[model samples]
Target: MNLIEQLKTILSEEQVTTNDVILEQHSHDESYHTPHLPDVVVFPNTTEEVSKVLQFANDNKIPVVPFGLGSSLEGHVVPEYGGISLDMSQMNQVLEIRNQDFLVRVQPGVTRTQVNKELNKHGLFFSVDPGADATLGGMAATNASGTTSVRYGIMRDQVRDLEVVLADGTVIHTGGLSAKSSSGLHLNGLMVGSEGTLGIITELTLRVFGIPEKITAARATFPTIQNAVDAVVAVMSAGIPMARIELVDTRSIQQVNTSLETTFEEAPTLFLEFHGSEAALQYDVAFTQDILKDYNCMNFAFEQDSKARNALWELRHNLAYSFIHSAPGKKLMVTDASVPINELPSAILHSRAKIEEMNLDAAIVGHVGDGNYHVLMMIDLSNPYEIEQAKILNEHIVNFALSKGGTCTGEHGVGIGKAKYQALEHGAAYEVMKSIKKTLDPNNILNPGKIFRDINE
Candidate 1:
């Protein structure tokens, strides 16, 4: 029997497929990176089954690319090499909810939104939004964070444990369910951002938060991008806890107005959220507004009702899709870079200036509270000049961040998109990472094209 028949023995024949439509869907993520089809796609319902498939793939030297919902922004799920696309969607399940412990154990396929839905009954919620309704496993793989991450933290911070299936099909738990431990290597940290280049995560135990006594959402418009970013820095320095603080540039605001049919001001703005007791939240809002005055905040508005607040954020979240909708037949190229809180002003200003210099149509949006921002640019794939401009712009942003002692990618993990910068960004540590890859996945079959192309390269 061939690999397809062999895989069928491990799973139902219906679970192992070579359907053209499925292969096409699994080929790439929401990235401008080129995609390639896997030879087959296999749906594994359990960790044991995932282990079996990995064992078979490893022994036979077939590449196995672990895939979740494919909501990745950096080509994390793209099958760059022809082999098995290990689809984990069938494994979706909320295994356990330890209410008192403020934790939940879930299959890798469980999405962030799904976890939140389940936790809502217990008055709990997962904080790492990542904008996309992405699988928790995929979010962990990318170490994703979104608006609320300014206070709630990233996927890496929320993961208490991970059940990882190794390249040789050996299953291991990388961490304990306890609150804290220093007993072994920080494997949870190591695995969370591995982007499936290290091993396949079959399950995860994550931390959750109780709903705050009060939640408020607000928008602050600034006279200039520099003023907006500077105001964010001031808010941070004031030591008032902010649940979410996002920067949306004038261009992005324009897109939002067009897409959402709202008549908000087209200027640099901050989407703000405060979570705490009613009294404490009021204090945070007052103090934040006080600081914004020093930086020329143009206008301020807030939403208190849950439905209204959700709608406000929904508009911000859809800005990327709005850009796509406006640009006919154009793909998006997002530049990700993070710098120190103090350097954010210079970084964002320089980015805006550079885009204008290149005469590129782009908008700026970011988790400004974390000193991370993105340049959203539309590209025509058929136009070589447009493609080259995107590459040059991305590299420029990455280089600027590196010069300021920031990361090439703050939340988006280093999949194939950021692989080239790994060596330069990590320097000697990059070699250590390669060594770990060689030691853990000697065959290089676990998402082979990610992190970096090869140790030699």
Candidate 2:
């Protein structure tokens, strides 16, 4: 039988498709990276089905790229050397909710928003929100982090265990339900950020948090980007337990105001959130305000009303879309980098300078609390000159962060876009990673051309 026919036997015929529209949908993610269509797409509904599909693919030496919602900023799901695009959406289910243990078990296809909606019934939430309603499995695959990551930790921290299917169809559990362990090698950490290169995650057990008694959101504007970033350093230095601290530069705010029709101050702004008891939140807000005063804060206000607080975050979360909306017929190349808190100011300033020097239209925004920032650069993909300039600016920003002992990508995984930097970023460690990849996937039939490029290329 042919590939499509063979896959249909593993899944129902309705679950396998070669429709042009479906192929197009699976070809790319929300990235500027080039896309390639898979020869066929398969939707497996159970762990056994996934195992069977992988067994067949491994025996035949066919590449299989597991796909989620395709909301990734990098081209993590592009199916570069496509044979099968394994769509996990059909398996999405909240299998179990362990409220007493603050844990949840879910299939690989569950999304962050979907998980939170179910968790909210028990006064719990999944905190590693990466701007998109990304699938929990994809979030784990990328080790994604967002605004809350500064306080709650990243995706790897929340993952308690994973039910993974290896390239050769062997099933393994990377961790357990215990709060901590030293039993064996740390496979959970390895698989969480492997980007589907080593294996496919069939299910996940994640840690969740109870809803706080009180929540407060605040916004502060500064005279300049330097002052706003300095204020972030000050707030972190004070050891204030901030749930979220995001920085939006003046250009980004302008785009937001223009796109959303809100009258936010056109200055560098810090969006802050705190979660705790009412008294504790009040004290933290007051203390944070006092620290901002020393950094030339122009305006500081606490959003007390729930609607207003939500609205404030809505604007911040939609900043990237605003930039996209403003620039018609252009693609976005977002550069992610992280430095130590002390080096954040220089890193951000250097990024802003490079953007200006290249004469490109870009904006600086980030989850500044954890020293990670992104430059949203709009580019005309068809224009070679524009693409080259964007690349140059990105290299400058990444090189600067690397010099300061930061990462090429803080949250966005090393998909095709950042693959070139893996050797530079990891040095001798890169060779170790290559050995691991080879050992697990000898045929290179799983998400080829991700995290590390072919030596010849």
lDDT by residue for model 1 (47-115), tens: 889999989999999999988888788888888878999999998999999999999999989998898
Top candidate on lDDT is 2
Looking at model 1, residue 146 earns an lDDT score of 88
Candidate 2 lDDT over residue span 1-457, tens digit each = 8898888888899999999999999999989999899999999999999999999999999999999999888899999888999999988999999999999999999999999999999999999979888999999999999999999999999999999999999999999999999899999999999999999999999999999999999899999899999999999999999999999999998898789888889999999999999999989999999999999999998898899998988888888888888889999889899999999999999898888877788999999999999999889999999999988988898899999999999999889999989899999999999999999988888898888677324
Off by over 4 Å in 1: none
- Each candidate: how many clashes? 0, 0
TM-score of 1: 0.99
State how far residue 387 of model 1 sits from its true place (Å). Answer: 0.4
Question: How many angstroms is residue 140 displaced in model 1 relative to the true structure, after the best TM-score fit?
Answer: 0.7
